[model samples]
Target: MKKTGLTIAAALAGALLGSPALAQKTVLTVGMQSTDAGVLDPHLNSGTPGKAMLQWMFNGLVRIKPGELSPEFMEPDLAESWTSSTDSKEWTFKLRQGVQCHHGYGEFTSEDAVYSLARAASKETSAFSSDYAAFDKVEAPDKYTVKITLKQAIPSLLGIVMNYHGGNMVCKKAAEELGKEGFAKKPVGTGPFMFQEYVPQQYAKLVANPNYFRGKPKLTEILYRFIPSDSSRDLAFQSGEIDMMLGRQEQAWVDRMNALPGVKVVAMGPAEMSMLHLNMSQPPLDNLKVRQAIAYAVDRNAIWQFRGKNISRPAVSVVPSGYLGTDEKAPLYPFDLAKSKALLAEAGFPNGVTIKAINTTLPSMLSFTEATQALLKRAGITLEIQPVEHATFHQQIRQDLSQVVHFQAARFPIADVYLSQFFHSRAIVKTPTAVTNFSHCKVADAEIDAARSETDKAKQLALWKTAQEKIIKEVCAIPVNEMMQLWAYKDSLDLGYDLKASLNLGPPVLETTRFTK
Candidate 1:
């Protein structure tokens, strides 16, 4: 049993629709498609984007500065600055004032922070509780002070705080007021917006929080419509039915939108890594030489060219370019079919190998995988692609049964968590561990442990570099490319995000405000 905090409390019921009170607010309609329905409980949601929405509906004690890169230790969202001991085992945070919860829970106190952190660490809670796995206990030293005791000296403790779903602060009174059942359906938190209602596979609505810590949001309300298909998404944009579309659509349609009287596109490509995950536990890939051969076979440049000029960048390592201090000079596994062939022969697969690749059906993503299929074929490898919907594709990865899978990993400021989650064998043991290392490469255990133990800042970076080298040397997976996400909306609509940091459109709907014409 994974001990994730408030997982049950976060379990959401079907969306509340069309109540007269819900209809009274101004609704700003947006578009989305169907996804694996997520529980509203903050800890239960999966990624950063989910955390972004939760940031609005519920606030944590500490939060990152809007539009800033990772240098964790949450600044005040509900709480002010925190001080940790030099040994890094103990931490004390002071709470902020005048904060109010959606259900009329009064000013926040040290007790709420203690309750929230303690709940997250409770083994009886849920799968997300392990996010607080390092914390031994959380205590309220005073009305405004929270003291936390840790299991070890982890340098990125604050980064852990900002770890999307881990730290959403809930009002204890609100839970008691609504009771378990009602609280699950209508949870309360301290944020800039409050959840209004959700119409499954249709739409979700939110109204501005009058008691928002900053000022109330300019947009009276936000309406998120679940319009899944790209064609339908394009149509919604064309007919003036939506203000923004999340993922990529037909390039022709995007061009049309740009040519339209009032539309613009913002293309952002961060150093985020998207790659093919090869399960080393499976045959064919069970041999390291075979994995290395696959890495050498693919022409990443050709993949980008397939979609036309500069849409995506070919990645040589698991660590994508542009993260803080990531040395680009680090060796890249370049495309060399000859070397790939040689490696395959050394592995005793001179005739090449036939393997199945689980790929997503998303149009933009399909292009890269198709190019992969073509390039691998030339290296004498036969890639039989298994095309499935994105949701199902992810579910399959979770099963750890696929020999090879094509997927995208969106992570942030620190490389540590990114390395730990994907490369660490203990993290992925597939038996209810703290994190899911989907690759199932149990062979990388020593390197993973070394990286985790390193706390000295400079030495940690060096250790991480060594770990990357080792993983590459052994051929963990063929890292493909970093996606360049593009977004287009009415020229007059200021989405209010710094393009450099706005990598994906999944969870964070931070500064989205509809302009008043």
Candidate 2:
């Protein structure tokens, strides 16, 4: 259901790669693997690195400038202030004056905000449109204030706003002028960096927004290089060709980087979760007993050892360990091969069943799939892992091509957003209105919906707890690992904020980042 907005001409424009800087200007170059920048339209998703890089060029009305110690805090961004109705159905925003878009896109106004939200709330352009399902209408009282009325009171309304959490707040005038193809090539936003040049599969360059509302960025330029090979990225870092990088996931790689002088290896916690989802519509796995067998068969400690204990821990909740409703010690189905085989026999598959799964060929992902294949073999299950290119894997999974889809993703703040996006019947795949419910498991619909409606924080979390417990009790999915992320950088720069963890898995390089030398 994803669309590519890049025109042939725009793609050709992106093909002409640029050389790295010859001088030591105030610039930071980040290296990564894979070059699918998605649509580059904020309305559409541009994978993880694209969104992290976009943070330099875009702002929501309010933003999460997470603290060095406490990242959950929210702060004001484009919208200086606002108020909500007593019932939280009607909300109003007071826009800040003197903010400018990157291009000659004219000063941003309520009209732009109105257009952005309506587009984000529509499924034609957005994957998380259901996240904004509560919005009834958006109205602009004047140039400085915008009001949004909700269809129903949503407990996580603040999390749904298009402007917060590194999501996009696009300008209407710029988008219409360029059209989708042109806009994808040359996006205009109100952030510290502006689009300078883009060369697909090679590099994207951004220059500081001089007239930024928050003041000009300290780093004059950001140069992003696409180095798809893991060994190539490490060699680039070691040879002083790149400034920073998100390194490989195994601990041996982290230890190697740590041994090098002037290289900083940071492990950022409360990060992404890696889960093995069972396609309930698929054969054999459709039986609850068979699904439970897969859960009981997993030895989480073995996975921790294979992946690295320093980077991961056994996951107990569909929610991450630090969050509410998470229990690390007493998972409903703890590791027990005997129980796994027992369930398999009860389901009439005593000799076990053959299951086919697919995943991207990223080293970390393939590593987990290999480990799973080995362990499941001991439990009398045959697993065939089909390796596909990153883009094809994402596309094929939605088509229900695999019974097991193992995916890794960054964290979301609210439990309701995570559960609903992955579990709700309305979010199930293959339907015309499909979202992210890949498993097609539907035991906790009542609780998931109730959690969204509950206004009280404590009460709302209890509902989410019930829903998470159901995922385990019924063996809908197996929570393989929940772990922090590791990234390495040359010791020549000072990243102003804490990189302990980011909403997006990349480092927070912004106005505060600059070279120490």
Candidate that scores best on lDDT: 2
Alpha-carbon error at 491 in model 2, in Å?
A: 2.4
Over 1-517, each residue of candidate 2 has an lDDT whose tens digit, in order, gives 5536667656555554432343344878888766555456766653565766776788887766643322246667778887999988999989898789887777888888888788677777666677787788999899978899998787666565634332468888998788878887888888888999988878999998888887888889888998768999999999888889877888899899999999999888546778888999988889988888888888888898888888878776876676543444435677889998888889998898889898887777878888988988888888899998666777788787889989776545566766777778887877665666789878999998887777887888778888888877877788888667778987778888766766656776677678876
Q: Each candidate's TM vs. the true structure? A: 0.83, 0.91
Q: Which ten-residue region of model 1 has the weakest summed lDDT?
A: 9-18
Clashes of each: 11, 2
Alpha-carbon deviation at 423 in model 1, angstroms: 0.7
The lDDT values for all models are 0.65, 0.77
Enumerate residue pairs that collide in model 2: 14-200, 60-163
In model 1, which runs have C-alpha deviations exceeding 4 angstroms? 1-26, 33-37, 47-52, 70-74, 105-107, 119-131, 172-187, 249-256, 269-271, 307-311, 325-327, 442-448, 451-455, 495-499, 503-514
Superposed on all Cα atoms, model 2 deviates from the true structure by an RMSD in Å of 9.2
